[model samples]
Target: MACKVQKRVSLRRRLHILRFLTNSNYNKLKVALENVKREYENLIATRRDYIRLLDNNVNDNKDVKIVKISEGTFMVKVTCEKGGGKLVAILEAFEEICVNVEEAKVSCENEFSMEAIIVSEDQSLDVTYVTEVILKAIEK
Candidate 1:
């Protein structure tokens, strides 16, 4: 009958519309995902550059390690060769900027290590300044 044909066509049309909407939503989600990935990649690249600059600036005469123990706190630990007095002075200067050695121990004659915690009181201290301090300390 004609009525039966009309009902079938209407159902078919509804199903087609539903499929189109689903495809559109899927495309939108895909685009959003790509945008997020790109932004994340950019952030990672920037962080890498900043870290590279810091590492290069730091004195490499010995083995100096800086690790972030928390979100806003960092620990600078250094183990240097004999006569590392210059590096010590540089670290001491950090005290003026509120960087303090929470624990420092110097052994008999083979090793010396200090755990200095750097926490910015104003959250405005740039890592560049910290890098400069490290470089200056190692300057010959």
Candidate 2:
């Protein structure tokens, strides 16, 4: 009985010390790697936003564009000749992607242009996918 208890205590102490030594260094490295990865992701997102800003209005005879302005925000620009109740459907599509409109403006100078600033809680939203969805909505 005495030998069993000593062995169990020795095993427990060894496990505790092993865990403490491994977790500190391992956890620190893991956290640093995660932080760097997030920063890289955000940097990629920023570059995409910059590129879109330059060529954002490329109509090419198409309507609707979802452009990411920053990490958690996007600008949705849509052109429609018929501007009665179509904005409602576009807004619905944006909401489906978990976005809230921060601001919206409509201007018509031979072409109706609707610009909306949208924000989302999700930081990893796929910019291209959302743009495609908005394009389909505008197409309809």
**What is each predicted model's overall lDDT from 0 to 1?**
0.67, 0.81
Among residues 3 or more apart in sequence or in different chains, the pairs in candidate 1 whose N, CA or C atoms overlap within 3 Å are: none
Q: After superposition, how far is residue 29 of candidate 2 from its true place, in Å?
A: 97
Mind giving the per-residue lDDT tens digits that candidate 2 earns over 22-136? Answer: 9998999999999999999999999999888756554344576778889988888878665545677778888788888999997767666788998987888877877787776
Could you give candidate 1's per-residue lDDT for residues 89-111 as a string of tens digits?
75666766766556554542654
lDDT of 1: 0.67
Clashes of each: 0, 0
Top lDDT: which candidate number?
2
> Candidate 2: which stretches are off by over 4 Å?
1-60
- Top TM-score: which candidate number? 2
Error of 2 at 80 (Å): 3.0
